[model samples]
Target: MATFDEINVDISVVLGSSEMPVHQLLRMGRGAVIDLDVREDEDVSIYANNTLVAKGQVVLLGERVGISITEVLMRSPEIRPMRTDGPL
Candidate 1:
């Protein structure tokens, strides 16, 4: 069996998103803030390897920041059936 260790997965936490024109995007410089569509209490989407896997909330621990997982997503029709011959 192949070992699960040493495998690297890309994790992405999306707090919010914004849309703007190309001209406005190009004109923005340093210290520019683009308002997002989400509020402070909204849950953030968590992606693993570019796939949406879970949802979480942004947390602050002292000076550092982290994410607290609130829910785990399961894909429909992807779950395998249980073995009928095995004693599971």
Candidate 2:
């Protein structure tokens, strides 16, 4: 079993659309462009626990989505649970 401390997953920060009304939002159809609030060519930040961890480029692969890790912001030390055993 893998614990939270034993997992390493790639996370992404997505730019959200602003100034869009919820009523109009409900009318969005396929292929509609919902512009994200980010600049082009800008690095999309990825984080863990509110801490910046990496940056990546968005990519598409055969209708699937992917991210290419560009930089690592921080690499923290591993955490371990307390345990004690003794002869009885």
TM-score of each: 0.81, 0.51
Instruction: Score each candidate by Cα lDDT.
Output: 0.92, 0.72
Angstrom error at residue 46, model 2:
1.5
Candidate 2 TM-score versus the reference: 0.51
lDDT of 2 at 26: 95
Each prediction's RMSD to truth: 4.7, 6.3
Q: After best superposition, candidate 2 residue 64: deviation in angstroms?
A: 4.7
